[model samples]
Target: MATTKKYTAILLLLVILGCQKQDTVDNFPIMGNLPMGEYQVGFQTLFTYDLTKNAIPYSDWDGNLYQSPTSENGRQYQINIWYPAQPDSGTRLKYADYINLMGRQTNFGESEEQKTFARQTFITQTRNLKNIRDTENKEELNTEQLNQLLDLDIFARLDAQPAEGQYPVVIYPNGSSPAYQSITCEFLASHGYVTVAFAPKGRFSSGMEISTTGLEVAVDDLEFVLGKVSEKSNADMNQVSILANAISSSVGAAAVSRNEKFKAFISLEGGFISAFEQRLLNGSSFYKPENIQTPILFIYSPHPSIDPKYTSHLKYADRYYAHFPKISEFAMLNYGMFDEFIPDIIGAHSGNTKKGFETANELILRFLNQTIKGESGELFDDSFMSSRNQIDTTFVLPSLPKPPNMAVLKDTFWKEGFDAIETIYQQLKSEGNPQPFSMNFYTEYRDWLAWKKDEDYVYRSRLYDLAYDSYPKSARINYYAGYFSMKREMNEKAKRFYRQALSLCESDEDLSASEKSTLRTYASEDLNSLLK
Candidate 1:
């Protein structure tokens, strides 16, 4: 009886201690107060319209289109800027203040009723993301706990006086939440960067679409924001870089490919690393990986399914891949979870969310300093990362092969005839090297041959045959094949090619509407001619 009483007493004490520890941890700031840098952080919200493009009617979260009372002439943008600021004695903004800004984002000059509705919708939608951590585990937070999150204090001051200096700009394309990556933005601002982010919307709706057109819309929005940032007196537009997170990394990749103004690109848990995103990017005309001449940094959590070797495709740029063993992609964002929330709620592998968040910010800052600020240092050396057991870094330098002189192909074709072209193609194929020429190269060369078809029907026919063999599914190439076959008086071959072109047009979604129409019209015409 004495031993039983002693065991019960020990169990009771352990329970009491565990409860006390839980309560103490719960008292800490929900977002795990990240350490601030040298400068004070100043934040402001600006609303502007891009007159170059027309604003399309947008749909709400429930797929209902919003009918606005006032007339909208062009694309509406709400720019949230966090910049280095002069220290002030005023009270800094709370997290709630930032949350409240989401209400006025789309309806800045609208009625109070609209703003109120938007605010409530924003709050409700945010609260609904309890299962954002993973599919299996859902972390439920009651009203009181959520209120604690809103009441938490953050570092950014509202409309504080700007510091007098030209600072490099960092453009962040936000994810689902308007306040997404707010902690990282403030941290960067405190370190003397003009970090800006905006809510990304699709061309015709508030919700972003997953198609190629949607990707273009996001890129256009980024470009519009960049143009506005250039107007700021303190912004050094020459040193602008994009710090893209999650799905926005696709937009960043497309932006960096087209625009030479972006000095560097950083991907935080980038979506492009996945195979699905890779196919989506390759489908877009703007995704020219070869054009990315600036440095890039990819910060992502290591996952068993993701192979880091695929990232070597961006051969024109110096790339750095940093894998964090401690955190998942979702934990990288500030979602108002407690410091121990990720590890306790998610799993042991998730690690300490607070430490992971701080480390990610430090890595981003250090990389930006080296690439954009041109600061000389061994900040990214393996030794620096070796000290941090959680991080694994790989540096990939540019490996550009000398492009085959495509001009030689045209010269050889004119001098040595069609047989010479076939010989070169066969040799290149036998060597198992297709990098020298792309599908576009073949298409352009085939078109040029068609233009000079008056010289010899055999030349155009032979080239079309090669192109069709190379790109069997290309509707454009197939249509041309039919046209050239008809010119050679091969009516049966012409009909087959036309039918195949139409079949591909029906099956392939990558072709544009105009291209499809042209192929259909021309292929039909050729088919009808052969049938008659």
Candidate 2:
């Protein structure tokens, strides 16, 4: 009897070992259709947009939208969706920065910066590379060369999921900017629509590539892409919309004009303004905005009047309002103070841009949700004046903010805190029984800093409790504790301890993805080991 019992235990242990080995191979995560999250689809990887092969000009005719002379080329563009991948897929996506838009050829970012450096380095010896003829090519790289100079990558987020059933589709043609497609695509996706960022024909195969020969060509491309999506089993044929930005705005309008299937049209900083007008305030392709059978949504920056290049788009809005009496929704948003690009600052300031981008995106989501799903309420009132009036005030914010300066401060904080933790880590490597407090302390400090900038109570509370339990030695333990205590409505305790904790805590973690992944790996390994 004793021998049998001992053998049974050994057999059971062997079986457990076998199961552990199996788990590693079964790493592909089983994802259920939960509330939408980021997902990178395989179809997005099939092709790429190569702007280098078909260079399109990006010159801002003064602040007006610049059309590449090569815009007349046949459609052959590429776009990649940067979305949330299903967790446990064991796949890491390789993101192509803006340089990828121009095929795999040149590094536009470096070339642009070098242009200035070259000017400074040689002064008169060499004009900017733009003027210098290529010795090997024996020709001045004109429109196509300059067109490839400015490119941005497209990243699809998990938020880009289409709602169940055949839903309407929207094609967001990026104007003046490459990354804008993801922003608009994600926004429409959140509202249960199948949105595609069409890489213009000049770009990679993954994205929609349309000719810039005014609105008619854009409309044709929209129709072409929609037809392609409609062929898919998941696409809904009944309802559809097209949203465009900058130059694409005309494209969206033109598309709806010819295709009755398009239920609505939205223009972000877009209008019937003709690209051909000597000045920016030209009339759009649609003469009577009210006659536009489709409902239109216009999202504009509130202070375009101050922006030299965007100033003319404001007049287009006036023309739109004059023509389309009661059938439009307008959202004019203040992007924020940091977006101020004063001279030398150029594109450096983004606080306002981000704020506006997010707001515009959310508004687009709400608009699509109500219009496509046929959800009715005061929210759908098209006659509502001003963009701010149409916002959905009920939805809670989804993510926490990592402030603009967070990146700059990361090294400093990590040196002070992470270095100390590394020391403890090394000691543990030698079999020292160090408490698992460092990870917790780092998480709390990072979250607290996030809370300070964005005031997200949930993130702040979770981090605080984690720190309190994991690293009591942490200098800011009390701050986190006090924060949550008050957040949980523990007013007295919060008031009593917040000041004390805040005073003691040093700088916090920036909460980089690498750090989070490390923590996750450790936890997962431990959980697996314990199960054994």
Q: How does each model score on lDDT?
A: 0.73, 0.41
For residues 1-532, could you state the per-residue lDDT of candidate 1 as single tens digits?
9999999999999999877522121243543545556887788877888787767554665667776642376777889888988887234667766666665555566456654665566455544443444446444445565466567777777888889989999999874444557888888998889999887788776667777777888898889888888888879998999988777888888899889899989988888677667777788877766667788888888765455565676765778888887777656777424435433333234466667777788888999989888888865676667656667555555544423445787888778876887887767666654443455666667667768444557777777787777778878778878888888888899889999999999666657788788778888887987888
Local accuracy of candidate 2 as per-residue lDDT tens digits, 144-242: 322332221222322234223554666666531233254345334434556666533223222223333444444554566566666655566787777
TM-scores across all candidates? Answer: 0.70, 0.41
In model 2, where is the ten-residue run with the lowest total lDDT?
395-404
How many backbone overlaps does candidate 2 show? 50
The 10-residue segment of model 1 with minimum total lDDT is: 21-30
- RMSD per prediction, one decimal? 11.9, 30.0
Cα-lDDT of candidate 2: 0.41
